[model samples]
Every structure is written in C-alpha cells, then in structure tokens.
Target: MDPSDEGSSGKRSDGQIPVPAPVMEKKKKMMKTKMVRFTQAQINNCIAYKEEEMPDYDSMPSIIEILSDDLANCPQDYIDELKTIDDSREEDKTFWIKMQNEIRDEREWILRQCFTKGYAEYEVDIDDDDDEDNKVPARVAAPPGRRRFRNGVAVKKNLSLSGGGSVRKI
Candidate 1:
C-alpha cells in the first residue's frame, strides 16, 4: 500500500502523528558554568580575611590548657618516642653546626686569597725639567710593607654591637 493512501486506522500511513514533530522535546540544554582558578594570592586573602573576622586572643591560655590536656591523654610510649626524636634532632644539629663552621672557614680562606700581599706595586712619575742639575733628590721610598701591596685590595670590617674601632685589612 502507498503512504499517500489513507489507512483504515483513520490516520496517515506514516508512523508519526504529524503534529509539528512533537515540539522537539524542548531540547533540554545543559547549563554551563565557568571554572574558577585558585591562586596563591586568593588563598592568602582568605587567610587574612579571618584575621579581621575572628575573635580576639583573650582565650589563648584556655586553648593552650585544652591542648595540654589532650596531649596528656596520649600514650606514654608516644611521649617517649617524641623525646627520642628530640635527642636524635640534637645530634643532627651538632653535625650541622660543624658543617656550617667548615663552610665559614672556607669562605674566610677565599676572602684571604682575594686580598693576598706582594701581589701589586705602586709607581710615581718624576720630571727632570724642574731640576737644574737634571737629577732630582732621591725621594724617600715608601715603607717596604706599604710598597709591596700599596695598590692591593683593602677592606675594613666594623663591629656591629660593641662600640670600638673597626679592623682594617689589606
């Protein structure tokens, strides 16, 4: 049977009811929302916000008391472990102090090398035209120590806390 011919069911041969495509089911659209990026500045702002909004420090001792009580409830073995950890930390601290001293000594050696003596000399120009004898009086030479490193690097270090004269270097 042709689709153009009316069917005995009192409808067209096409399965659709021909009612403007049933309004297309309204095409339920998904709502899109923007994704916000979190930055360090924004996090810092949030931390500072509570500083202005939160309560004062009057209850600090009470908070400390509560924390102490909570800690007191912890097992003895855990406290012993904490003490052991602290002792181990002290051992490591001594090692670190030794290493720091070694580094400081190395830096001092480098500074000494940078300011070694006998590495430079100084000269002064003399004119014979002013002397009638064409020979000038022998100029008193600079001290031997001064002449050797006259143009070498010099440094002055000042004491920070105590009131005293500074130490000079050459």
Candidate 2:
C-alpha cells in the first residue's frame, strides 16, 4: 500500500494501526450551594411545632416545606442579608465567602436542631397509662466530669468536689 494512503486506510503514518478516540468521560453537573436564612419568629414557630407534635423522621421533609412556605410569606430579612453579602463580594471576596459559609453552617445547624434533634428530645411512652404525663422530655445526663447547660450545650471541666486543687490560684 502507498505510504501516503495511510490516511485513507485508517493507519498512522508511522506504519502502525490507528487507535480509536479515547471514550469521552461524562461530565457531572456541579451542585450550586445556596445559603438559606430563618427569622427568629419563624424559628420559634418551628420549635413550638416540634415540641408540640414531635413528628418522626418521615415527616422531616414536610416540616422543611412548612418552614420554607413560612419564610416565603414573612419579611425579606434573609434576602437583605444575601444582598449585603453580594454587595460585599466585589470589595472582599474572601470575607464574603467566609461569611456565606458561616451562614450556611448556621442554617444547617438550626434545621437539624429544629427537625431532627427536636423530635428526639421528647420521649413517647406507649405503655404508660397517664397520657398527660407520658410525654416526658428527654434529658442527656452529663458525664461525671462534664456539665450540661440548660440549652443542651455541654462543657468538660476538671471539677473537684473535695475543694481540692482543681482551681489554681494565680
């Protein structure tokens, strides 16, 4: 075969068989992360609902939808915050990014507390005869050396009951 005819014969000019094109890997869609904010009133309402009904895991999506609808009808405080962040993005990109991340984290934590942990805080006593007293609020007992706060925040301390050297005199 004519060496110049390699192009027509599907062969490389170097007398080697041509290899097919490498399979193109599919590109994955990148998820856009958006920050969501909640007002104090909305948060209170969600907490109240959680405490009153205490829906199970299956109802979490419905609870989230309710909160979203409430937010839609409420004032635009969250939108204002988003605008502020957007405005500052031109001046300081790093600070804006950090603030955005902090806002996202805080929003996630609030949702988790209101939806997941909130339901878990109330224990359902199925066998108890007293219906009014059956719904007991759960409490996390702290470890021997730990102290739990009223809001459920815990802190570890080297406390000595014998009035020993736990506290150092500076």
Candidate 3:
C-alpha cells in the first residue's frame, strides 16, 4: 500500500482523512454615489435667454411670466433660481442687464466648446469607395438563363449550378 493513500482510503481501522478548511472570500467595497450639478455655463445660458427675450421697460413682465412660456422642459430648481434673482433685485434694470451679459458670454463659450470638440472628433472615410457623395449605385440585372435561385428555390453560391439554360418550376 502507498504511504500517500494511507489516510485517504478507508483501509485503516480508524478510516480518517484530514480535510483542509475552506478559505473565506473578501467582500467588495461599495462605491459612493456621485452628486449631480449643472455647470456654470448651463446656468448662464438660461439667464441669458431670459434677458434677451424680455428686456427692461415700464410695467415689464415678472420673472415667472417671462420664463413661463420658455421653461416648459427646464428643471424646477433652475426656474426657482431665476425667480429668486429677479425678486432680490426688483426694479434694478442696470444690475440685471449686467448679469444677463455676463451669463450670455459664459453660455456662448460653452456652445463654442461643444462645437469645437464635435468637429475635432468627427472623421470621414476617404479610402472607402462604397458610398460616393451619398449617391445610390445603379442595380445590375442578372444575365439571360442565369437565375440566382435554381427551380425558384434559394441556395447558397459555390454549392451547385443549374446546367440547363432555362428556369424550371417544381
């Protein structure tokens, strides 16, 4: 009898084999949730739009009135912020106009960045001759008595070819 199989097999009177303890797996660490916030540029864009559409005048429209028609899809927080700004500086046309221009500049800068990045990343396949200036290629008809399918039945190419120069129906 082999010494290695001494305890492994039930040959011995005791009939016992030592079993190794199972290793415990380490638990994965949970990742923290990231906070979502709008960029300064996006905020500025909203403010600028408000100023351009509704200028200062006697009995001018209220902040909510000005933004009502425009901000149908905008977030509640954004609309609230605009209203707060307007209420805080009531009848201060100069301050509002200055703020509007600053916001407008920032918004424009963000738009320019988006356009620049998009244009830079865009690529054209110059080597590919498949599509020439978006024009569709003319379809070529099959030769006489050379139908793609045999006996009106579809089959893969390179398998077999119909010998007769006439189409047959089963």
Candidate 4:
C-alpha cells in the first residue's frame, strides 16, 4: 500500500496511532469579563432572582451577574451588608491605587476583582446608585443632649439618692 494510503487503512505500521478527533472536546466558554454598569435595583433583583431560580445569561454576561451567582451560591448576606458599606470605602479602594490595608469585606473584594482582571472601574459606578442611594436620605448626626458629669458639677433636677426619698438634688 502507498505510504500516504496506509493512513487511510486505519492501521499504524509506524507504531504511532493518533487519537481520534471525537475524543477531543471543544474548548469551554470563558466567563465574560466585561464589567457593565448595572443599576442597584437590577443587582438587588439579581440577588433575589437567584433565590428562586438561576440567572439566565444572554449570549454575553457581565462579570457582576456571573460573580453574583457564584458568590451568592454560598450562604451570605451580600445585599444587606452591601447597604451598610460606606461610599468612601468603595471609592478609596481600587486596582490603580495601592492599598496599605487589606479589603474590608467579601462584597467589596468581589467587586474590586474587576480591576484586577483589567477593568478599571469603581464599585459605586458599577452599582449605578443614581436612584437607589437617593431613596435613602443621608445619615445626619443627632443633636447633642446633656453631658455626663463625673465630678457631679451639674446638679440633677430629680436625683434620687436613697430609696425612701421621693426626690433629691445631687
């Protein structure tokens, strides 16, 4: 048989038989790394959506959605804890900026991952808090009330020293 035709015979005369193409599988689809800005409502919906059903990714999926499912897979409070996170905390930490301290929590750490993957963005911008943040008014400090007097300099109006006395001045 012709040397070229020998290959067609399905026999290896050279003692070197290559594996069949059927055994080799196609490459897996890599998760989309593109960081898209999602509104806070959408993100919250995503969190809630995952509770009942899996999120269906389109032909392309954002990192947030994919990571949300991945991180949400475990028992965690990504949403409730996210609310308490201060804006400055997210703003100050970024890939571009070198950090003196480690990340604070899982949520922020996960969001900032976009930067390490080459997406330059902030956690706040990604959340798109244009409306969600506005709904809740900014926290204001309460008026300072009476001061504590360890030295007893300020006298009390109705201070009771002994149990028998109805009222006593300190």
Task: List TM-scores for all candidates, in order.
Answer: 0.25, 0.20, 0.23, 0.16
Q: TM-score of predicted model 2?
A: 0.20
Quote the lDDT for 118 in model 4: 35
Considering summed lDDT, which 10 consecutive residues are worst modelled in model 4? 49-58
Question: Tens digit of lDDT per residue, candidate 1, span 25-96?
Answer: 554344444434334464344334421222333333333344565768788787676666545655665766
Which TM-score value belongs to model 3?
A: 0.23
Which is the leading candidate under lDDT?
3
Question: Residue pairs in steric clash, candidate 3?
Answer: none
Give the CA lDDT, 0 to 100, for residue 43 in model 1. Answer: 37
Flag regions of model 4 displaced more than 4 Å: 14-26, 34-170
Per-residue lDDT over 26-125 for candidate 3, one digit per residue giving the tens place of the 0 to 100 score: 7544444443444666545544565455454547666788768889989999999988876765557667777878977866665665566531122233
Give the alpha carbon lDDT tens digit for every residue of 59-157 in model 4: 334344456756566545675454345333434445323332232243345445534653333333233443454587768886698556455354435
Query: Total clashing residue pairs per candidate?
Result: 0, 0, 0, 0
CA lDDT of every candidate? 0.49, 0.53, 0.59, 0.45
Instruction: Please report how far candidate 4 places residue 162 from its true position, in Å.
Output: 37
lDDT (0-100) at residue 91 of candidate 4? 48
**Window of ten residues with lowest summed lDDT in model 1:** 50-59
